[model samples]
Target: MSFFIRGRRRDVKEKKGKKRGLKNKQVLPVKKSKFDSGLDEEITSDEEEEYLKGKVNDIAEKEAEDVETAQEKKVRLAREYIQELRKERENEDDEELDDKAVAARLQEEVLESAGKLRRLVAETFLEPVSEDFIVLKSKHQKLPITCLTVTNDGKFIFSGSKDCSIVKYSIEGKRLGHIPGGRKGTENLHTGHTSHIYSLAVSSDGRFLASGDKGGIIHIWDGETLKHLKKFKSHRDAVSALAFRHSSHTLYSASYDRMVMVWDLDTMAFVEHLGGHQDAITGIDSLARESCITSGGRDQSVIVYVIAEDKQLRFVSPHESVDGVKLVDERTFVTFGQEGSLGIWTTLKKRPHHMIKRAHGCQAENGLPNWICSATTLVNTDLVASGSMDGHVRLWKITVDRGHRKLEPLFSIPIPGVVNALAFTSNGSHLIIGIGQEHKLGRWFKDKKAKNSIVVVSMKKNV
Candidate 1:
């Protein structure tokens, strides 16, 4: 019985060994088939390639983010530094001082330190003798060009003429577009101005162009396209002057009816009307503030209207008739008259702070002062310019020392025509003058040598 059991165990061991050998043979052949087909190598190569591409994309994204962060940090630091400087300046001033006076002084100091403030440097500007000035003219209008306005960017100029036309021109005196004067009895037709165009204004944003005419009509146009958009007929008489408040669509228009009307170009409607002048309102001007300065012709009055408060400040002018007005800054303004005088005024004073009698000198034949028909200021600078029939455009520099302000003669450019309108570019690089044979408002005098055209004077000697 022991021999039989031993023999059975040997048989069982042999059967187990045979089963292990069969399993090993099956697994080895399956592995050899996968390697020979190249499927495993292909999958591994594809996964490696995808991993490298993802890594490269992540690196590029990180670098871009780092660069952007650096730029943002630099800008933030600059803004913070400027704010700190402003705060330090404000703290150094006495708190009891007038806020406007302190702000004005602080602004000048800040702008100067930042190198943003520019003045007519006597050395560079004075060397440009009258002959150095280059004058370019465009003769598209048949009649006198009454008013001229330059866009804030100094790229385009719009001029209104007595022929009931409005002409658009480039800075190089190239005519871009023209709106021909409509025929008589065409008042109802919205084609163009039926009467003479007396005043023109372009908004600071260069989005709206406004023109006032002798028929008490105000037309709004697309500043870039010169397409008429809307018409306003609120004034009862001829609209003489139009001004747009700086950096806004608010418009102030003066008319021969002795009324000043305010309009909102955004809503295309009238805001309100201001009345104070006893005679015709000849000129109007405004800055970034909510106020405007207007000159009353023949009434001998200069009125400042505060729109927000509905209040007006009236000052008596020494001139026979104030013909033109312009704002030098928010707190100060300048005006010219038919008596050939230029008056510098401030909102704080009832009388002119300084006056220059016979600014452009007198007429040779009549022995009377030449009429200063137009005047302009170089935005925020101390530069002022006046135009007349005196065959020259005079520039004045405002000197302020210890609260005392006065005008110092800078120089004059020879322009042989009746300068009915004067406009300065935003950068003070050019002066646009509308020249004509007759005066804008009347035929009081004629310049036989002058042509009915628009003249552009390059202010910079090298430009």
Candidate 2:
């Protein structure tokens, strides 16, 4: 019985070994499989392929993650760079202060205080602006004063007369020099106009003076020496106005010849001619940009033309004959007409933004509104002054209501004669007025001698 049990155990062992050998042959290639030691060193073909595929996926995922991280780093760095540039630009814009900037800042502060005081006074008592003016000086003219301009520094005042001459005077009314009439033979005097001097303009630096005459002659002079610089034939008819660009040597002249001429002071040559008006161009003024010009004429229209483009950007008739036009600011301008109508215009619109019908306080015997001869704006203020043939000067305060500007009558000054021209000092401290007789076809008036006067009014100085 022992021998038979031993023989059966041996057979069981041999069958177990054969089964193990079969499994190893499936797993091993040429060597014994490490799976016998439970190390998993050997694998089937299907298992090996699965392991390689997983390894490839892992490496691909890592590479993709690295690329994404690099892109994110670039984005972060670009954002930082843009932020730094914006900060630098902001700092530069904030630090651009100069002497002019300082002066402007102080002026703005003073104006703010004054405006507050004015509002307070108006609200407290509902009182009118006092004749808040005092006559500083008055000088008589030999001829009817047609136009006048004050120097920016308030040191000199130039008066043009129908008598064909220009007179220079100190701010104190002291006579400085007389620019002779006629451009023919006077070497000692400026090549004055042979006809009536109707318009005058001074350079921004107060170094040059320009005079235009009824004969279409333009005379340039040294403001300091009163010497003739040059004489040019500008138009076929009377030259109505002259304006010098601020801080530049460029000049513009409007003529009854229906043309506006541009000149270069540095070259003393004509640059170009701007023409669009159908009738005589009466008034012309330049914008602060010096690239555009605003002109009005008897054609009953106002035209704004761009110099570089040589194109008329705007043309409109405000239902009246505009005799005078003046730019008050970059966006705003004032126009006065033959019917005493004053209108405010803007660059964005072709029509008048505001209109003051019957701006002059008086009417004519023909039952029509009196003529508005000239108009000007006070420096650094929203005050507009208009002169009329009725011998009255009216002041208007510009205000905004419902996003539209309106001119409210502030005060009126009754002078002895018809007001021909109006101007203000650069600082708005004084108002320079030119008065003359309103002659009808050579008929003299009662106050003919009383006319042709230059009046200097102290504004803020007296106030």
Candidate 3:
């Protein structure tokens, strides 16, 4: 009887030992083989402690994963989103580069094949009947349009008006946007001009659009969205002109305060101010060079501001006022004045290289020469146009004969209103005109018969 009782006790002891080994193996996976060796094997105190620690660690890890905080989850998602945006931007940049390469190749082919072709002249193609013109008028701009500017791609046009508003139009004469002007005391509104907007300019890259007002305020806007970005208030008088350096964000502005100021659009800060004009600057133009050309109103001077050297090259104009100026090339420019004379000038000379007196002809009623209010040139071409109240917008062809440049009348388009501003598309395919009943500077004269509108003349290439 005693032997049988001892055998049962031994069997119970072996069963408990096997259960202990299985628990250790489950907790400490690395010790599974040792625990499976035999139920008779006894685990050390250190081994038992390690098994407990491993069990705790596993439980903590699972809890941490399940209890992830909302903030941590958000951070993970944000990291993934930013990575996606970076990838998209990289893809877009690659596409832009490929497109540019193809465009360059096409342009090179056109130039090479056309080498033997006759020199293209604007006169042969610019003749448009009255019906060929597209007139854009807006109810938001009830007053006369003061200035107009076209984008480098010839896709959009921006027009400023005496009503203190600005209207944007597509090349197809569709109104895209309108910035309504505020009252005089609403300068803090920062929506649109509170005074007459005299000039408008867009950067060559189509990233920035700048507008100047008669109240000496300059507003910078996003080129694509037309949203106001910044405002500059350094000039003390009416801001007469605004221009952007080609392929850059550098802006040059002229004012009636007899000062020209430079602004960097990238930094949204003023760079420096130039002082050379004795009177109000009426017109300003710039090209690829780091310089600008301006006409001095009543100063009878056409000054070229060399920004790099901080020097001014002043050319004396035969006309009295020198109301407007436009650069023909890097060194040559054209100017017109209130005295009804047009002058072609070069930076190398102090006087005009060529002068056309009474170019617009005298008025019939008063027998006085009609004042040439505005002028523009087809960049890098021999084509120029001038505007006045002379009942026509005259186009002139610049003829180069043995190193001498002369202006020859090509044709005229009968525009009834006082032509305040003119701009040519970058490719010289279209001519934009700003016409109004009253003069841009002031109410010096009124054309009751004229209408306030923006006219776009489409010129087909003469093949």
Candidate 4:
């Protein structure tokens, strides 16, 4: 098992070598929380040397103040390092706690929703999402915000709107500038299908931004300069969604044409395409270049595909539960759906660790399927939050134990109305909710002390 894990890690490193000259591979936010064992080991040896030096100071009373100052500085430095790690790890830990609370809430809601007899279900579960949070009302746009990106380092928020423009905002939600893909007010968008802004994916480092449009065009932007990096035409009919492979130059783009295409960001090349779905592909997540990918489509199926030995979509992943996935750890992950369906699965063997059905459905669909309205992954915490047409943003908690897995609905917070998209801050402490087909974009608090009122949202926060 360790070898398998090492092999995956090595694959990522090898791909970095392959990223030369192609599309610039972007750094993804680091998801692993355990302290670096190598660094810890190296620190042990250095600490011993430091202790020996301290012993020398102990024997030489000539410089007692200097020795005391050095000792104090060392200890203070160590504490500061630990605090930084904690800040980084806080989001991941919050996920664990959130999963616990959300799972319990979902258990009850699903039980109740199951009694409603609603079939084709798409239910979202969220918990005490602050009702008193602030919302930045877009004044000059027609399309609601459909997609958003926060730099891995948590510096900025880049939002894509149906208005055919990509807007960059500060981490707090302040609109800094806008990249017009085409006309802002008119429908003369540059998409091959039409001019609507479909979706957007910001690179982990927040240095690159990718947007998909209804016309099957993918635009890449320099996150800092807001300059156009490149434009790639899609083989799919209408580009609906796009995702960057974690820490790599490869990206996955899906479209209404029922195809998923993998692009080599460094080489500006099309690596492969996995086709067979009969409906439009709406949502996508890339775990790695060749390991696994999850996609949700209008066909009412959330499908998983395994990268083959030749680095192609192999169609080996499971399609049973079909819930949207949020990658928590290499061995643990969570999933959610519109029908009150959520599950936790392990890709180590493509099997579910935990499964729940009908968490938000009032009726049974007898088999006709539906699509989740909106879903977001806090890349740092691995928390899977999704909103449904049923007026809820559901959070799923995932527990990753070496070989054990636990996934449960952590909380079911209600939106004032239907939801279009869900996003959490880099710290996983705040949530920005875009109501589906609505004009309001709400900023909310996501903590244990979520009082009825969250912090006042200033459009300048861009969080």
Kindly give the number of clashing pairs for every candidate.
0, 1, 0, 51
- Deviation of model 3 at 136, angstroms: 0.6
lDDT of each: 0.83, 0.72, 0.86, 0.57
User: Which candidate gets the maximum TM-score versus the true structure?
Assistant: 3
Per-prediction TM-score to the true structure, in the order listed? 0.73, 0.69, 0.75, 0.57
lDDT of 1 by residue, 393-456 (tens): 8989888776667888888888888999999898877888888899998898888888788777
Q: For candidate 2, what is the lDDT? A: 0.72
**Cα lDDT tens digits for candidate 4, 44-157:** 778889977987977787675555676788788766754554454535667666555555544644443332211211122223434536655444344556566566666676
- Model 4 poorest 10 in a row by lDDT: 450-459
Return the clash pairs for model 2, or none: 182-193
TM-score of candidate 4 against the unseen true structure: 0.57
| CA shift of 251, model 1, Å | 0.9
Order candidates by TM-score, high to low: 3, 1, 2, 4
Models sorted by lDDT, best on top: 3, 1, 2, 4
Candidate 2: list runs displaced more than 4 Å: 1-140, 182-190, 439-449, 461-463
| Model 2, residue 170: C-alpha shift (Å) | 1.6
**Error at 40, model 1, angstroms:** 68
Q: What tens digits encode model 3's per-residue C-alpha lDDT throughout 431-462?
A: 99999999987897899998899999987666
